[model samples]
Target chain A: MNIYLRLVYRNIRANLDRASLFFELIFPLFFIFVQGFGLNGIVPPFDVGNGRVISYSLFLAAGAVTLTVINGGTNAGTQLWFDRKNGMFEQLLMGPFTRAQYILSIIFATLIIGVAGSLLVFGFAFPVLGASFAPTWEGALLIAGALFLGTMFFGAFAIALSVVLKSSETFQIVSTFAFFIFLFTSSVFFPASAAPSAIQAASLANPLTYTTDIFRAGLFNAVTPTVSLELGVLAIEAVAMFVIAVFAFRRIRV
Target chain B: MLMAPDQVVRVDELSRHFGDKIAVDRVSFDIARSEVFGFLGPNGAGKTTTIKMLTTLLPSTSGRATVLGHDLKTEGRKIRAQIGVVQQQDSFDQGLNVETSMDLYGLIWNVPKAERRRRIDELIGHFEMQEFRKMPTVDLSAGQRRRLQVAREFIHDMDLLFLDEPTVGLDPIVRRSVLDYLKERVRQGLTIFFTTHILEEAEYLCNRIAVINQGRIVQIDTPENLKRRFGSAKAVEFKLLQGTSSEMASALSSSASVSRFGRDEGSGAYRVTTTRPESVIPEIYRLADRLNLTVSSIYISETTLEDAFINLVTEDEKAVANGGRAS
Candidate 1:
């Protein structure tokens, strides 16, 4: 078996317990459930200047899944942090592995977590609250594409963050702040347009905004005109982040 | 039957620096097949740093090394695959139990199932860890953890093993047991690179011992050779009662057999270093009688590896201070 796959397996198995369970599964579900259901009861169901009558709960579901993918990135970074802290990082580097192998394994591990976390969101949202995975195979393919590119981008960011960050305390504060900022500035819980004009402008550049829109487009079976541009920007951003992560990973000392 | 180039390890001008601090300074050495090469040094004397370099855990700053016939820089993964390392610090996958940790390590090293099982049982019995093999590493005692850390390396076969202070935190019997096991393995054609500050362990297990101090190799020779060369000056220690022994220290320096000695400030005991303690010891008593000095206690012992280590390091410092001429 490939060592990178073995490492990814180990990372996934070692976590997924209490601490990771909350981040990867429970926290996003809780947020989506309370906010998704709460807003559906409060807000009058309306579309954003479109012919379709979109439910707020379904919109929150899209944001919730994006959050799951983002959490996967954080999980990937924490694996590097834990390995360094517990001496396994040296062991990994000392094995039949280069630094690139270790970092790639984290990227893959986060990709798995992000996909699984999204599945959990979709599974809950569709059955319990009557949401849908895009109606057509083409719609489903777009969701899959967005999930892959989104997870890859943030996963690379997390690993690159791990290599550059000095201490765990600082890493936690900085990554958490980055995660929340990304969440708030984008369309996970609400339309970026619902926020002030400044936040709306910032969301135009936030990669999560496109990812969330892509996800929402799939869930609502309503592909919009901007999906192609969104996919193109995401693909470029994902490649850039992964390239940066590779460079940073190479420079790390055992 | 021996090929001249069958050295399992060869290092030339190998150096490592952390920023401006030189951790390993242009060190060089070789280990032949099945030879136990002991690296002895005080704390922060580059012993662990050297081990880390050879084990491929840390990259060297300059120079070259080859392990199991692979270059250090380009063939690190190959070298790592062929050698086992027991680091100085005891660490484990805290989430795994002792059994799981051992099993996981064996798996990572690609040890096959049947062989891994056999080695695990053999080592667990050898290291006396069966009682708590099911316990998580977080719950093990310091000594128990250390034993597990050492024994875990035996789960896979390798051409060479690097042990950095392997016996530290172990009880006397266990320490000797571990060394004896290492000796037994060396007899079976395994090469061992051991590092320790304990001179006795080096003297016991090493075919050749390198005394290192301050990132430089002070002396590298067989323990017997090092002892024979540096052990010529035996030490005579005597305690004084109701008297300052500073006067006696100066008087003994003139004796032909006594080369040099000093007084222990805390114990008020005078140590006389001499090639012939027979004459120097009696001269001490004679000098004491004339001075009306009351003797509390006195004894003489042969120069040991501990003495050789101290003397070698002291000579190194003096040589450095005197424009490299003091030695």
Candidate 2:
């Protein structure tokens, strides 16, 4: 495992330049601020039981961070495909590390990116929204848990996709399809209550929906009974996806 | 466990197939400690397939093999821990710099942090990659990348090293340097199993070589033994200094000393193949003198590995053709 950690560390340090710190931190922070304030004027605020017009902008901030994590996680598999095409993947296979070690390294790197993105979102949202960003410690832990699992779940999904897809062009099409499907069906842009019954049921099945809801509940301290159930469902899906992904990846012919 | 002084690698019948195509047939061989064993074959032969199986990347279909006394099927992890493999294609992570890449590979082999740092420094100097140590691998040339790849394998002192076509695109100078480094490693008692299509590379580096064709071992012997056994035959080629009459060429072709002969249509030269070049040479000179035929150049040469390969493959093709007709 020390080897796996070192590999991940080396890769992240080298690629940190490719994913410029300015773009990763400052650009997303700027986008969240601009989009949050701009959308505030267009959509009317929601009325919670506390009688305050709740700014859904905080939800957007969380959603943006989650989006960054999702992008990084999905791109992990595409990066492996690129490596394979460029001869790097063959190198790793011939190394002393096992396939499990390789996959774990990817997952570790994704987790770091996801956590960093989430923290950056928090750093921006808490300052601008003031009292509206009041989140309990328990809620923060739950959000962190959700993001960690969500990143691994999607990252593993991408690994499975990498094994089945031969080319990056086909992988892009599949990634785009997966992205929009998760976005439209999840609670990223809207509430599950407003969605139709069948749509709500489908959202319940989508792991991203659970992740988004968990983030929303954590940031706003608005934990409904449904949130717990979604968290449970997401946990089960994360484990199942991880197992399936590892199994599928094991069968790949180096 | 450390290998006994005698054994480097040992295998019983090893086989691997992909779908309907058999990549490695029931093949087996052994290499003594400190020996450089070359797996030689043409493209698409079972060289890479067998190497992959030996390196524990691909499982054999039906076979038993051991490396340094560790069972390949059960102790693959242990075997892999002690072996280093450099694939045919460039396999280093291009995102990292040379030093970092070596450091990461060292860590993978469980080298201590201090040892890894020391080794990285040593290798960077050894490979003469200091100028490019800080640059990303994408910026390095093909030869430079190959140097890093070969250096990365030695970050930790492994008991066995497997290199697949390590000099595929390298120029002669760089190829020699890589081969010399491999030789040095062998002198340090590291068993090297490398594959290559270039026959001369095997002749230069390998103490023992096995030539595989169509998933079967066609021949296995030292370069000297192979040459003495299959490469002693000679070819005598001569070019006509002036255009000879058709009658003179036909008369030359009828000599009993000539085993086989062919005329070049464009150059109008004649080439003859014979095991006894001494007798054939005098006959050719006498015939030319008697006919007043001028000889531009007459050269007698020994057979090469390339010739042996062609002869072996052609013979195999003939056998197959005859078998088909018989069937």
- For each predicted model, how many residue pairs clash, with residues at least 3 apart or on different chains? 1, 0
Give candidate 2's whole-model lDDT: 0.76
Predicted structure 2, TM vs. truth: 0.86
Q: Which ranges in model 1 have alpha carbons more than 4 Å from their true place? A: A15-19, A46-52, A132-134, B1-3, B236-255, B260-272, B276-300, B325-327
Candidate with the greatest TM-score versus the true structure: 1
Cα lDDT tens digits, model 2, B1-327, are 344569878877799988999989888888898899988777887888898898888899997888978898888878877888888877766668778877877776678889988888877877778899998888889889888888888888788889898887778887887788788878988889988888888788999888777777777888777766667468888876776556556765787767787787887777788877889888777777887887789898876776666665566557666774122
Docking class of 2: acceptable
**Which clashing pairs does model 1 show?**
A63-A188
**Cα TM-score per model:** 0.87, 0.86
Query: Lowest summed lDDT over 10 consecutive residues: which window, candidate 2 chain B?
Result: B318-327
Per-residue lDDT of model 2, residues A1-254, tens digit only: 56767768755664445564446566446646787778878877774223334666765666666776676666567666766776766666666667787778877887787677777767766677664556589788878878987888787788778778878789878987987788778777666667899878888788888887777677667677766787888889888988987887787776
lDDT of 1 by residue, A1-254 (tens): 56876777766654334566565677777777888888788877766332556788766777787888888888888887777776677766666677777777888888888888898877876687765333788678888888988999988888889889998788888999998888899988777878899999989888899888887776566677778788899899999999998888877775
